[model samples]
Target: MKKFAVIALTEGGAQTARCLQEQLATQGFKVEVILPQRLAREREIYYRKGDFNSTMHRLFREYNCVVCIMATGIVVRALTGVVVDKTVDPAVIVMDEKARHVISMLSGHVGGANEWTRLIARLMEAEPVITTATDTEKVQALDVLTKKVNGWYPNFKENTKKINRRLAEGKAVELFIEPYLEKYVEQFNGFTLIRDIESHRGGTPLVIVSDHTGFAKNADIIHVVPQLNVLGVGCRKDVPIAMMQTAFTEFCQQHQLLWQSIVKVASIDVKKHEAAIQYLAKTLNADLEFYTAKELQKVSQKYPESAFVLKTVGVGNVACAAADYASGEQNVTQRYANHEITMALSRLHEI
Candidate 1:
């Protein structure tokens, strides 16, 4: 569920925050209200006047979205010390005590401030203010689109601005996406689809959606890496994290896969608490899934089997079986094995 923090500096603003809290709660959002000590009521967090900046920083760190029911200048000043890059910052929305206007103050696209601004404006019957160049010009923001598609920009800080600026100026940007993601073509507005990046001429902004790294050498090209690969691992008891990391890195290099494309790590249910497996999942920033031996045994018959593995884990293959089961397919795309670890790779066509 989405978490929201509503901050109010005065009694009237506290009332507004309470109303928003109720409405947002009914819509399945977790909302908390922060008010000044003099204005805070029951069930509200209170802070002193001198702690405004510190409080704002704390809220930004704790909440997914922050609604400041106060002057825009005050909100801006308090946030200047806490705000980070657009990719990691929380959405910040500012509104007057009277609820006349709801402005998307920071992280407009990647952090979903514009989306929250529209929702809050509709709830309070206020004017929504969004000033992002792409939004103002009615053009699609690549950063926002990437988030929606479960993708990340490899060159976010530099190439995103270059491409978004060209889009805001009403210029056509060329897009070359992997065939597996062709179903999402409708989302790419104001972009020309090119069959091959190799055939494209220079000068037009280009965006490539693929899992392969180093597909393009141009500094201007933006690479949107989709989360489409799953890694399955099985290791001996008490394996070192360094060995796991080395194996994972080598596997990615051998397969020509980007680490960002790995969406999940799968392992046998018995190894769910294994530190090496957990470390691998955390390092890849992917979800972890554990399958039972019975579930894996059903698919393990097709792959190569080891007698020692069967005696130890009740299944001939752990990595390939778990990967195939988690991917909802019977085929394992790649497989690797060492003395202490076994690994498998699977590609997911749909997110």
Candidate 2:
């Protein structure tokens, strides 16, 4: 179920969230409502925040997406001091205290503002205000991987054209979405929608979102994507894991990278393999590792953050560094694991 954190500005905001929660419950989404203390005059509210900072600190750390009963930007801005976790930044949705339309306010693309809005709109028979580029496009039916779209993925340049061409042709197309991705439906459309193991009839076009291989046998399900990128980082000495994380996030955004694209976390043996790195990786369902030092020195192209630990572990940095390097060729574009993880994605082309 798509998880949502409903945050209300006032007592009535909390109650509004409750009504929406009951409605969303029927649609199969996990919903939790957050509110301030003694806001509602009539109804006895269960939730109350003592220290606003700590309350939000714990909440963002736990939830995937947050739906604000009102404007939540202030709450989010205030919590910046304590909690820095965005691993599961709740797709922020704004609903009125009057229980009007559910408006997706932030994280529209990946956090699922679009699909959640569509679902709520359907339930309430209200209009879903979707403000996204990809959703309003003319999509084609084709076997194309769902690449993370923080910006232009040079590798996807080829695949995008193919999807457009297929779309232009009027050939029947089928879209495949991860059942778990139900929350993101509104952000995307135009392609035919399909659930797991569900095959399409005849030669319809297919779009897919899977972390593994072998989705459907028919040419109908055209693409299979790992749908995430695994980042194996080796920072220089004493580069606090916090700094590493901050820097990495900046690098990704600067590169228009998708936070979801990073699945696994990695580091070299010399770094003591700290908890912060593991925490960041775990948030993305990725494992943490400390490879031999020498292994990294070799794949110097993607340098490991070299430290004295290299002297402790005998191996060179080559292995760990090579672990980060990808074949410059666009065909080597898939990730969710280290380059050495050995994936047979080529089979996707067989159909």
User: lDDT of all the models against the reference?
Assistant: 0.85, 0.51
Worst 10 residues of 2 by lDDT: 342-351
What lDDT tens digits, residue by residue, belong to model 1 across residues 43-146? 67899979989999999999999999999899888888678788899999998988899999989988899988999989889999999999898877788767
Mark the regions of model 2 whose C-alpha exceeds 4 Å error after superposition: 40-50, 72-88, 138-351
> Considering every candidate listed, which one attains the maximal lDDT?
1
- lDDT of candidate 2 over 232-260, digit per residue (tens): 55444454656656755554544444455
Give the clashing pairs for model 1: none
Could you tell me the lDDT of residue 342 within candidate 1?
81
How many clashes does the backbone of model 1 have? 0
Q: What is the C-alpha RMSD of each candidate to the true structure, in Å?
A: 4.1, 13.9
- The 10 consecutive residues of candidate 1 with the worst lDDT sum are 181-190
